[model samples]
Target chain A: MNTTQTEWNLARRQIVGNAASIGFAVAMYGVSFGALGTTAGLSIPQTMALSLLMFTGASQFTLVSTLASGGTALTAVIASWLMGTRNAAYSMRMTPILKTSGPGRLVAVQLTIDESTAMGLAQDEEAFEGRASRLAFWATGLSVYLLWNLATFIGAVSVSAIGDPKSFGLDAAIAAGLFALVWPQIKSRTDLSVAFGGALIALALTPVVPPGVPVLAAAIVAIIVGWVTGRKLS
Target chain B: MMWFAVLAGAAGCYALKYVGSIIPAHILEQPIVKRIVLLLPISLLSALVAVQTFATSQSLTLDARVPALAAATVALRFKTPFILVVLIAAVTAAALRYFGLAA
Candidate 1:
């Protein structure tokens, strides 16, 4: 019993440490979102609603950026939806591991995001009975949700004091945050090639296409690269 | 119209999550689907970075974001903390703009 208690304590500490770091990092980016969202003409309440309901960073940013560029509502929604689709893939990957049901399943789905999924899957291999993984998921999800919303409120309220957010380069912070998120994922030659190719396509199309269209068009590059590479491997 | 878009977006996002929950594990685990899933974020995020950094009001223009993003790339290469990466990028761009070096 004593050893079991010790193990539980160790697992709790480990999970909390990981969750805290990721949650804080994510919350900082939420500030950038809040400032930019309001500058993009979203009311403070609207910005908060996006953070609360959509609760996905990249999708929320895509929605606001689309709107900022005078894209039609339909176009903004479509762009946001495309980005949100990734959460579906995340949910598919997580549901089996979580094995939730009924109301629990619904709640779990709401908390599903890239950070939580990554934290859950990153548990120490030697931890027993899945305790660490479960704790990591719940802790990271809850903390990030709480901190991100709080940061958003703070940022929105303080936007006036900060003057033009762009003057402070807060607008560029979004891309920087995104770049940091994607940095650790590019581990292979294929990943590097695909990323560069997609970025180039988007850049080339930006001047010619509508605001949100280039992003959608770049997905074609990803599909072709994945298909061609997969065929070659087979 | 904005409210309508937000509500529709919320509903669509919810549907995506719910649909993922209902799909069979074997189907989602297929090799082709898995490969696409893995590659999707890399491509999509890179595209997003490009659009957000370089595009403005339906047009592409060079600006302080270029140098700021370059600084961010260096910070990321050194494995700086994520928050620091953003701060470095922001400060770099802000300084450039303040000095009349970039719009």
Candidate 2:
């Protein structure tokens, strides 16, 4: 191991706080998702179903927001499925590292989310040896999974008493939640271009297109941005 | 309708992950394919935010969501953290509506 005694201590500290911290943060996100689900007119069971099955924060948010705006179920599903495509990208890096297979592959796939992937990859970058990376992945993933679901249940039931979700400003809160999710990802000018370009397209098309179709149509912005700006990364 | 979206959407997303697991890495790692996959969510999520904040039905309207998002931007600019940004936006919108200023 290339790690020093001090480095081991530091890594130990990180291991202690890292997954728990990430899990707490994601629990907050899950609470918002739960509230958003209910405010968007989903029943409690439906809300829980999305949390348990859909699992991905961005995809779940897309479905709730699309439906809230009167998009058909098909559009809602497509938009969420589109959002979840990023998970596929992450899984590209994750597949070989995790080396999961058979029935265990199913379990691994559930944890193949943004936080777990990021944590796992960070450890892999730190130590080329796979042990630390795998540990980080499971610890972070399981903590996030347990806390996120529990918080969602709490948020859903708590908000059930509110009258007129708009009066509570949940609509704006939902948008803000989406914004927060993307803000951290916008670490570069090109990333900003893609995000802003996509927002412009969606806003422009919102009036002309059907409620959900604009979201789907906005997919072209990323395609064009990647072609012009990001194509060199073979 | 509810179960259809929940179950089918989950299935679709899970399928994407499962596909990546089984697919040849060389194919999935193709530059253009990789680039687009990385960029796709950024665009779609930003687009969704726009639609949620501005659009109501077939028309774009100015409302509390606008100011609320603006509040969130300020909070983000200050590094106020994610939960606070969300809370700020909600509270801003709620305050405005409570005062009968914006719906």
Candidate 3:
């Protein structure tokens, strides 16, 4: 085949691979989130709205969990925003790569989350690099967005029929889903150490701090470790 | 109150993303920023897992989530399919609860 045709095929394969890797997992997790949101006292529409608009798993979960526990609106918003800051960082990393414009730019911003960014960056550096990366981004972003929303609707509607969400162990599913997403990223001893340190920080602070403070504190620990270790290595 | 929080959260999140998108690439590509971004997800996600697993209504406790997390970790280490990892974790927790071992 000609170079262009071969490149197109490679890009297509990469997009499909990336989408398939995380799409179902994300959709399933969306169901869990939807049920949790409803159980947390959010109306079905409100739960759906969070997924449609906020569109970040950890942030949405933080918002609902905080609210469910009687946290003030300000606290919930701050917690969710803090959790979402990573998406901003993801956007910065992806902006030059996406180079999108107009309406597409708006949509791209909406879809810029951990899964899409990771999928895009996972593209092979050696083959049809740019095109494949963009394809992976769009493919994973679009598929996850569509499937997640649909699953949210289903979960919200079926929540009553499913009865108590906790009895089904849905409460633990969030951590499991997050764990799955984070697992592939920890590639080395340093990464593992950082992860353990962060977890320890969060755990140690959980009892003494406000609902959301532990997470922010853990982020600080990670940042300090990153800065210190990075300086040392450099 | 709920509506206000949702709208504000959405707007804030969108702003965060837009600000990142508009920043000049050269600025974001700095070595320190790059390292921060690389390390951020690991720490953030680990924090998330710990909070979600251990905290219940601003309080910490030992519960089924601990063992479920352990199971999920093992499943992940084995490169189990994502769905299976979730299922294993959920089932582990549910069984523990059913057996009166956890709340």
Candidate 4:
């Protein structure tokens, strides 16, 4: 095949591959979030609005969990923002792929999220910094968004009558997706150490702090570990 | 209204993203920013792990039933399938509750 044709074909496969490998868990986790939000006392519209508007599953879940526990709107908003700070990093990583333009800029921002960010980076070495990767990245984001919101609505509607989420294995959905996301990134002993340290810090902080904050604290610990060890490696 | 908060929150989020995208390519391409951004996923994932593993229904617990530490260890050693590891750990917890190991 010609060079341009080859690039197009490869991009096509990457987009499809990302969807197959990562899409299901990303979408299903929305169901878990929806159910949990409803059980936490958010109404159907409230839950749907969170999924449709906020759309970051982690942030949405954190917001509702905090609200359920009596956290104010301001508190919930800050927590969600903190939870989503990683998207900025993802955006940075994708900057090269989706070249800065008026329309491209808006689309890129709309598509920024955990799965697309990771999937965009997962493209082959050369593709990582090219337009093809951006195409794949946007595809992943749009597909996940559509699928997630739809599944979330289904989950919210069903949660009221479903009784216990634990009974249906719905609670495991988020854990499963997180595991998938984290697994591919563990490339070295240092990464493993940082992971362990963060997980430990999170465990230790859980009792003293709220649910979402522990994760934030763990992230800080990992960043410190990265900064400290990063110099030696460089 | 709550809907307004949701819209504002959504708008704020997209605005932050647009701000990130608007930085000139040359500026964002700087070596320092690139290096730091590379570690962003680790930061986000760290937050996620801490919350899920440590925080329980209302309180944090180091109890055996949660066993996230152990499962993560298994995930490391076997390079086990992520979904499989999550299933094993989650099943352990639900089974514990089912069998009266913990509440």
* Candidate 1: segments with Cα more than 4 A from true spot: A124-128, A232-234
True contacts kept of each: 0.63, 0.80, 0.66, 0.27
Question: lDDT of model 4 at residue A206?
Answer: 60
Residue pairs with backbone overlap in model 3: none
Write model 2 residue lDDT over B1-103, tens digit each, in one string. Answer: 9789888888998888777777778876677776777788899889989998999987999999999999999999999877899999999999999999997
Per-candidate chain B TM:
0.88, 0.96, 0.82, 0.63
Residue-wise C-alpha lDDT for candidate 3, range A1-234, written one tens digit per residue: 898897688769767976976777788878877876887778899999999999988778778766764566777787677667778788988887888999999999999998999988887644564877788888999889988888888877777567777777877876787788678889898889888888899888877777666766777766787788777666
What tens-digit string does per-residue lDDT give for candidate 4 at A128-208?
A: 346556666777888888888888888788888876755443344344445445667778786777767766776676667
lDDT tens readout by residue for model 1, A39-115: 77888898888888888887787778767756677877876777777778888877877778999899888889889
lDDT of 3 at A10: 73
TM-score of chain A of each: 0.87, 0.90, 0.79, 0.71
Off by over 4 Å in 4: A1-22, A61-76, A93-96, A117-131, A164-183, A203-212, A230-234, B1-12, B25-90
Assign candidate 4 its CAPRI class. Answer: acceptable
Query: Per-residue lDDT for B12 in model 3?
Result: 92
| Greater-DockQ candidate between 1 and 4 | 1
Best by TM-score: 2
What C-alpha lDDT does candidate 4 achieve relative to the native structure?
Answer: 0.63
Q: How far out, in Å, is residue A146 in model 1?
A: 1.0
**What are the per-residue Cα lDDT tens digits for candidate 1 across B24-100?**
87765666666676777787778878877888866788999999999999999899987799889899999999999
Q: Which stretches of model 3 miss by more than 4 angstroms? A: A1-22, A66-71, A118-133
Please give, as one word, the docking class of candidate 3: medium
Q: DockQ values for all predictions?
A: 0.62, 0.78, 0.59, 0.32
TM-score of each: 0.90, 0.93, 0.83, 0.71
The candidate that wins on lDDT is 2
